[model samples]
Target chain A: MADLLRLDRDPAAALRETAQRAAVRDWTCATLGLGESATVLVTELSCAEPGCPPREVVIAVFAPHAPRRQCRIHCALAELDESRVRAAWLAPTPCGGSHD
Target chain B: MTDTNDKVPVTVLTGFLGAGKTTLLNRILTENHGQRIAVIENEFGEIGVDQELVINAEEEIFEMNNGCICCTVRGDLIRILGSLMKRRDRFDRIVVETTGMANPGPVAQTFFVDDDMRERFALDGIVTLVDARHFGQQVDANEEAREQVAFADVIVLNKTDLVTATELEAVERRVRAMNALARIVRSDPAARAAVPVDSVLGIGGFDLSRALEYKPTFLEPEYPFEWAGRFDLAAGRHELVLGEGPDPDMGLALFPAPPVEAEDPARVAAERAFKWFAEDVEANAPGTLLRPAESLAILDLQGTGSKRFPVQVDAPGRYWLVTQHLPEEFALALHDPQGRPVRPGLERAFAAGHTHDDEVGSISLETEEPLDPRRFSDWLSRELQAQGASIYRMKGFLNFKGVDQRVVIQGVHMLTDNTTLGPWGEKPRRTQLVFIGRNLDTQALIDGFDACLAD
Candidate 1:
């Protein structure tokens, strides 16, 4: 549950310290541009039951760039099921076109 | 090592002109893709390589040669192989970039004929780069174009970005008719698929024995021989047929017109007819009268012998330039405009270098010194450079002072990149350069050639 509060470890330690110093003012919310500076807060996530995933969730006090970032993440990862990749792996090419 | 087991691999990079063959070559060098590769460039441009330094010293630019006229022994190609055998550790692959007009048969023959070369290097198949845009036109003009396709085991339908789907399909069909066995990959040099040099070379692009299993038919295969004169014209000889395709019903005996020997009196008659054709084409076409090529025919480079050469015609795509040369003795035969029996000792030259085959009316000054095993090659290369624009292809057997065997110098048109083919086990001989061109001047060329003589 405590691990959910941070992002992945930076390979180059240089950017880590930059992120660390800015954390005093609850920087993750500001970096995400999710809300007004005063409204955002860093809070740990609690499971509805005893222990589930998302042990921490930075609730979006605001979400200005939500659509754009969500779409980009979806494209790169394509975990979203709508992609043709989700279709039958061996689907034959539709040869129904009027080739004439 | 006694070396019976040692084998050399020859890799061929072939493509229609402007199909990014050079672009692919540059990437191969800059990336340091693998072992050392000797690049043979078939050029449409003057600069061989713009880079300050290229990896392979054996890399050579092919201008034009009279190989089409000379014996198909390909002595120069063998010599290049001889040189490669010496620097066994220097290069891993021998990449031969054939002229746009090349047939590839003679180049391949080099691998089979020489026993020593056969032992050292094996044929590594051909990688053909096809200009997806003009693929149809190139394949249609002459069987040589089709031969390039058939010989290739891998065909890169390059410049895919420039063509529509229909155009690509037509090109694909023509290529398929010529070669069904080849693996076709469509790409632009910018595409990542084309980047990995191994993708093109590592794939077996050609199989000679397989190519021989072919049947050529002129079934109106959507032949594009009449494509606009304007296209990407690389330096090499083109066989322009005034005669129709052999009638299929006539069977095997229906041979095309036997090439008129330059020494034959009939060759003079053909040259006059060709000259009249050029003059008519210019009068009708007007301003484009060979705008790209500046004709140079002077008893002296000075104004006296150097006439305003209006008879010469440089076609669009800057491809073929037709010119005429006449021997001083046959001057009278041409003075009266005769399709008559009086022979005119003239010569015709094309992109394949000089051919003084017809000495009566049209003379093609063939640069064959390099073809001879007796001449000096480096000197011939220098001579070829001076008469640069007029050259089609030149192959010469060379000898560097320190080396005991022969080295081959192969040149194509304005692309002066040449490779050291290797050393001859036999005594060093004169470098032979077979020059094929339209209206090429042999004597004047010889004078320029004299200058390239080794000091």
Candidate 2:
């Protein structure tokens, strides 16, 4: 929680996080073999579920006519690495059907 | 890394078919608002006619994966907004024009659900246009129409000249019933969808605090509680008895009712109670005593078929009670110390429900081959003339034979517009087109594009 609040108090921290997220998104796309048309969303959400980390990064992949795929990393966006992303993608969890 | 105050303001424009959304959009672009505005439109048909109607701005159209009706976020909006924030200096604000049949839920939800969007862009408001004469039928016939009215921060009743004053009053009544919170402004009939720029732009309709400041009774339908009751109480301990219900615990808030002279007293108290219920919860086990304070308290109703909690009232005055669910659902009742029922003097139910349009959908067409300009134009004209009624919105980039620049095209029904958007340069030239509407023939559209390919 303090780390997330630092993003609001420090401009440098926010910029660093934004850059890191963009890099992670690019790496995820490359590792997952997703095209430009596919929409890749990387979000850092606070986990309320017991036994889960305080904060985690959720990466969701959406493409036309394909089932939505996502993976959760038990770490903050800054702590995420390419190896972790690849590992998550390899054992990706199927997301719920439709946002409706 | 801009501060929250410096984030760009975005306004979402939505309405039913033939509601003068494009006319209002043109007025916004032509007006001297002193702000450079970038417009993103999701037209129903494949030709970009709305883009041509817009002046002094380049059209950027992105398609979302709407094949699954349950997809929550508008993928196209997320992609376009992400790119727009990168070149934030180019535009002062952004206005998104959704297709007429759009639900506007996914469009508005995109701002809050996406982390990057939430940080960089603030949803200024959702402005909906209503065709004064046809709104009544539209609202009754289409769920999308009703949802647009329900979710608007500002409702612009356009085409007033076409309807009589009596008929207009009836329509306004219907709009008000659908959304009591929205500020309804009648458009200038002589000017055609003309509205005061300030009424729509720069309004913090989405800002909850600002909304509450503007209207003390500002309550969104998505709140947890649905009903609020005002009761006249004496200075003593009252008992709140609850029967078996769904949840293990129930959230409750008790606050001083607003003065009788206050405007919309019921809503004012409801809004205040809503704030209290959102605060940190203080849980009380069954048979425990709870003091009525300006905060939230939870009653643990588990393990007992019926639980009783004492509510202490400090002073004899009017107090409001807000429960997480309707009291009837839990068979909840309040009693005076003597065991007599303490009935509420007033009760108000907040509107709560969500609906989506399942009939409307989008089709995407893509080809690597460049098109013959003359042949493509003739085919498009013929298609719009024949099937424009069914085709709601169409937009995409076209790669023309012997033309270096990329041609942008968009259309709504019979209206179509196109412009050459500089040379493709080193990028690959591929024609991508998308049509959003009802009852579209996928094979026919694909074959039509194939026929327009250069030999």
Best by DockQ: 2
Query: Taking the tens digit of each residue's C-alpha lDDT, what string does model 2 give over B1-455?
Result: 12347888999999999998988887887788898888887763332333432212122222222232212456667666655665677788888888898877667656655555666787788899999989978976997897787667789999999987656765775675555456788999787789998888988775433443554433334455767888999889899999987678888888787566477676787667767766776679977877778888888888857889988888889988888767876788999978899999998766432232334444567788988777787777667656655565565678878888776664444434444557899878988776655556767887898998999
Model 1 ranges off by over 4 Å = A1-100, B1-5, B42-71, B189-195, B205-455
lDDT tens digits, residue span A2-96, model 1:
01111123446425433432342243343443433122211222222233332322211212222111101111111222222212111342111
Tell me what TM-score chain B of candidate 1 gets against the true chain B.
Answer: 0.40
Compared with the true structure, what per-residue lDDT tens digits does model 2 show for residues A1-100?
1121121147677578879888888888988798766667786654445676776776777665455567667778899888878877775352311221
Which stretch of 10 consecutive residues in model 2 chain B shows the poorest summed lDDT?
B54-63
> Worst ten-residue run, lDDT, model 1 chain B?
B246-255
C-alpha lDDT of residue A33 in model 1: 39
What tens-digit string does per-residue lDDT give for candidate 1 at B337-404?
12222221232211111222221111212232333222334444445445543443433344344444
